[model samples]
Target: MTISIAHLGPPGTYAEQAAVFYANWLVKKTGIEGILCPYPSIAQSLQAVASGQTQLAVVPVENSIEGSVTMTMDTLWQLDSLRIQLALVMPIAHTLISCATSLDKIKTVYSHPQALAQCQQWLEMFLPTVQLIPTNSTTEPLQHLENDITVGAIASSRAAQLYNLPILANGINDYPENCTRFWVVSEGEVEANYRMSSISPSHTSLAFSTPANVPGALLKPLQVFAQLGINLSRIESRPTKRSLGEYLFFVDLETDRSSVQMKSALADLSIHTEILKIFGAYNVLPISKDLI
Candidate 1:
């Protein structure tokens, strides 16, 4: 079946590139293709999947350095319309892409804010005194720099190639290693290459918030995880919306939802917080690089 996988943008961005990676994996493993769709934002993409406009959608959940994306985290809590079919971890590698043929011609740098943060150190090394411009998306700045030799944009090399821009330098992230984990979500049944049974299958994501005034409310769950030997892969807290004094916590742990341990943890978490919700766990295909 053609599974609509919503990514970000028309052709090239980290999300679109990652979608290609996912498509290759799914086709090779499950024989599904021609359904990879790209959207502008997670909300738009996730909405499509939730509305049945698309069969599936890919939403960025976390960056290795940047933690969780607040909107995505919020959706995990508020949007109970869809279930997460897979968790994909794609390593992000930022490049110093430019429209100019030579680095000497680049006087101003343009990129999305997140890309700038990711490559802050590397950009500082070469363009410390240069002007930094923030645009809606990395690809947008690249598109805007079409004929301006004095302006360059940092984006994916795939984007650079698609736009016929040049990559002046690559591996420009401040950290040598940078990656983002995304969720592949869908409304109903979908085909995949792997099953939970292959990798201890049962899993889910929990996003919650508590009264900031309460003491030790946050500590309660961590204490439970420690006591339970639950290996937490990630935890990020974001300030609550429309409330200045509250905070929301997004946590990812590996546990088979069918197991007693998961049930106990969920039950305990429900009692420990003001609110808690689960985004269901489904099968996730292994990222390609993991094979090598």
Candidate 2:
């Protein structure tokens, strides 16, 4: 049987590349065939797995240059049944693509908002007076290209090649260390055998909320982890959307979710928090020169 995997795509998306990489890895490790199912948005891609439309979904969680993808994190919190199975880091190199062979002929720049932000310095230096338009995805700009040499796009080299557009400038991103972190989410809880094989450390993601605004209500659970010597890699608060002053704390622990200390800490933490949702335990695939 073929496994269906969903991702944000229309063909040349970074999410698509990541999904294909994961599918190849899945086949290599387990001898199982996997297929791609492209979704219009990150939330929909993840929803495909939650709604059983696909076996798994790959979506970006964070970028080295742009920080966390808020929509992805919010979707994960809303879709509690989905758990992170594996994580992959892909190098990002944005190129200026267009029908124009020369940068001087370009009049407008188009790309995803995040891409625009990442290449702000480079764009300001080269195409300072051109109009910048934001599209849904990096690959979306390719569809709007016309015969006009005035229009340009900031997308991946794969997108440029796929669309048959000329890459006028290569590696236009402000930072050479740009990379994105993607998570492979699937239905049900995380399984031990599905974890990624990487030299980097493991992480357990979870979300919790307090019962009331009582003193030290939030601190108690954090104290539990600290007292147990569990180091937290990330901790961010998002609005609960139920009421004012109500928020959800998302935490990433640098340890296995199945560890003895983690279980003990969770048991104790439950006493202080109203809700504790454990997303998953997974390993991070570090960025390597070959991964690009």
Candidate 3:
């Protein structure tokens, strides 16, 4: 059966790039055929999988330059059926695509908010007067470039080539090492066909809510991991949305969920949290520069 993968699109977005990489990797590793399905928003892409419209969804969870993707985190928390199957770290290179003859001719810039923020410093230095507009995806504004010389879009070089647009500037991101981590998520248990060779130092993600916002309420759950010597790679808090002070804490642990230490840690952790969710344990794949 051919697996269907969902991602943010009209095509040429970073999320789609990660999805394509994972789709190719799936074929190489397990001989599973996959097809790409594009959604207009990250939340909709994830919801596609949750609603059984697709088998898997690749969504951005974090960025090295801009930090965690709140949309992915919030949606993942709300959808209990979804589980992360793998993590892909892809380097991001922002390109200014336009029909303008020179930078001075550009008056408006368009891109996803994250892309715009990542290129903030460079834009201020070069295109300071251009109006910065945020779109649904990096590729959304590519179509408008040809109609107006004053309009430019911040997207990938691949996107420029895909749209057949002229690139006015390359490597426009504020940081040279900017990258985003995406998660291949699916509904229900992880299929055996999706498994790959063991990649060491696996990560397990989870979320939990405290009974109340009392002091020591959050610390009690954290201390469980500390006492067990299980190091946490990330910990972030999102509002539960039901109340102002109530929150849900998301964490990334450096051990596999099936490991003995992690099993024990969760058992102890549950005592302190009102509700707990285990996202999944998965390996991280770094896309080589040559591949990007």
Candidate 4:
């Protein structure tokens, strides 16, 4: 059977590149040929998996320069059937694409909010007077060029090649260490080859909310991990959308979820938390320099 994989795209998106990279890895690891299905948005790509339109979906979770991608995080928390299968890191190199060849000819710049934020310094230093507009996806702006030389898009280099647009600037991201962490989620559990060893230490992602709006409500859950010596790699708080002052905490711990210390800590944490959802436990793959 062919595995249908979904990703955000129009073609030549960073998400599409990630999907392709993971597809190759998946085939090498399992001998299964994977087909890539591109969707309009990250949420829709993930929804395709939950709705059984596809077997797997790859979505961005966080960026090294821009913190977390809020939509990916919030949607993952809301979707119950989807679980992370593996984590892949991709080096991000934002480029300035337009019909014109010179940077000064560009009057307006467009890109996804996250991409704009990552290239904030470079834009400010060079195109200080240019109008910065946010689009839904990074490459979505490419379709709006309308033969206008003043319109520019901050997108992937591959996007420039695909759209036949000239890359006015390269490596435009302010930080040289720009990278994004992507999560591969699916409706069914992954096979043994994809599963990280429970015996070895691994990364675990979970979301939880406090029982009440009282003082120290958040501190108690964190204390459980601290007391257990469980190292938290990342923690983010998102508005729960239920009420004012209510929020959900998403945490990534360094130990395997099946470990004794993690289980005990989670059990103790349950007493203090109103709801807890363990998303998944998986291994992380670093993006190679050649892949960038």
Candidate 5:
């Protein structure tokens, strides 16, 4: 059966690129083809999975430079039984592109709203508070412009080249450590990382909240990992529907809990926390540098 996977945009959106990246990787590994479904928003992508219309969906959970995506966090909170079965990171390389003559004459900068926000520091430093226009996605910043030499768009190098836009500069994002981590949500076993199956099963992500909603309740479980030398890849706080001040913590522990240390920590944490759910344990493959 062909796996139906969801992402963002029609094509050339970062989420779509990520979905294609892993889908192509899967094709290379297992010779299994996938159907790529591009949704208009992350919430739509989540709904596709929730309704069982797709086998999996790739959602950006966090960006190395920009921090967690708050919308994705809110969606996860709304999804009760949804699980993140696997995760992978992709390097984000932004470029200043134009269809016109020179960067010196350009008067405007256009890009996906999030992309523009992420590059605020660099823009202020270089563009000198120039007019910035936000497009729906990075891939179409050029399409929104008036197609003149006085305006330029900041987008991926792939985006520039694909649309015949000349790249004025490469590696333009403010942070060099720019990588977006994406979650592959699914109910079936992942056939993508069978080569590293043994090592992959040791990493797990869990979401929980404190019963008392008291101070230090959330940090309590983290201390257990510190004492046991369990590495936490990422931690994010989301609003819990229980109350206005209440929150839920989503944490990723480096080591899978088959070990005595992990099992003990889970048992203790469960006793103190209100809701605890293991998202999944899967091997995350190393990401490659952006080819642009």
Candidate 6:
């Protein structure tokens, strides 16, 4: 059967690249034919899977430079049916795609906020006076490049190639080791058919809200993991939106959800949390720079 994978696009966004890698992996591992469905935004791409419009969605969860992707985190918490099936870490190299003859000719720059922020230092040094506009996706501004010499967009090298746009500058991001972590998410339980023997599940992600805002309320659930010797790889908090100080905590454990320690920790954690969601345990695959 064919699987429909959704991603943020006008075609050449990083999310699409990650989805393409995952789709190719699916073909080689399970012989499943995968078709990509591009959405205008990350939230819509994820919503497509939650609404059953697509079988899976590939959305970015974190970036080495910018930290957590708040939109993805907030949407995942709000959507009850979606769960992460796998994670892909891909190296990012932002290129300046434009029709301008040189950097001095560009007046306005456009790209997704993350891309813009990733290259913030570079932009400040080079195009200090340029008007920076945020678009829904990196490739959203590509179409305007050919018609306007003064317009430039920050995007992937693959994007420049795909759109046949000229690269005014390469490696424009602030850092050399820039990368993004993308989640291959799907509705309901993660199918065993998609799991590969070569890949080992290593991380478990979950989110929760405390029963009360009282002192030590959030500390209770954390102590459970600490007592079990569970190492938290990452922890982030987002506004619960219900009240001023109320917040939701998202954590990534180094152990799988089915592990004995994790099971014990969860049992103890339930007592301290008002809501707990297991976003699922999944293996992480790193996409080599050459692959991109």
Predicted candidate 5, C-alpha RMSD: 2.6
1-292 in candidate 1: lDDT tens per residue? Answer: 6567787776777777777777777777667674767677778878887777887777777788776677776765666767776777777777787667777777999887888888887778788778998876678777667677788778876787888877888878888667787777777444444223356554566677764456798898777766776777678787777677678787777776656777778777777777776677655554654431
Candidates 3 and 6 compared by lDDT, better number: 6
Q: Compared with the true structure, what per-residue lDDT tens digits does model 4 show for residues 1-292?
A: 4688899988788988888888777677777778999899998998999999998998999999889989888888889767887889999999999887788899999999999999999999999999999988888889877589988999999888888878889999999999999998987566655434344537889999888988899999889999999999999999999887789999999988789999998889889999898888888877685764
Q: How does candidate 4 fare on TM-score?
A: 0.94
Write down the lDDT of every candidate, Cα atoms only.
Answer: 0.73, 0.87, 0.91, 0.87, 0.76, 0.92
Candidate 5 runs further than 4 Å off: 146-148, 188-198, 241-244, 290-292
Once fitted onto the true fold, the runs of candidate 3 whose alpha carbons sit more than 4 angstroms away are: 197-201
Error at 168, model 2, angstroms: 1.1
Candidates 5 and 6, the one with greater TM-score = 6
User: Where does model 6 exceed 4 Å of error?
Assistant: 197-200
> What is the per-residue lDDT of model 6 for residues 104-172, given as tens digits with 9 covering 90 to 100?
999999999999999999999999999999999999989878999999999999999999999999999
Q: Output the lDDT of residue 279, model 2.
A: 89
Which has the greatest lDDT?
A: 6
Q: How close to the true structure is residue 269 of candidate 5, measured as C-alpha lDDT? A: 84
Residue-by-residue lDDT tens digits, candidate 3, 1-292: 5899999999999999988888888998888888999999999999999999999999999999999999999999889889888889999999999999999998899999999999999999998888999999999988877889889999999999999999999999999999999999999886656655465438999999998778899999999999888898899999989988888999999898988899999999889999999998888889987886
- Candidates 3 and 4: which is better by lDDT? 3
Root-mean-square deviation (CA) per prediction:
2.6, 2.1, 1.2, 1.8, 2.6, 1.1
Q: How many backbone clashes does candidate 4 have?
A: 0
Flag the better candidate by TM-score, 1 or 6: 6
Consecutive 10-residue window with the lowest summed lDDT within model 5: 191-200
Supply every candidate's count of residue pairs whose N, Cα or C atoms clash at under 3 angstroms. Answer: 3, 0, 0, 0, 1, 0
Listed in order, each prediction's TM-score against the native is 0.89, 0.93, 0.97, 0.94, 0.87, 0.97
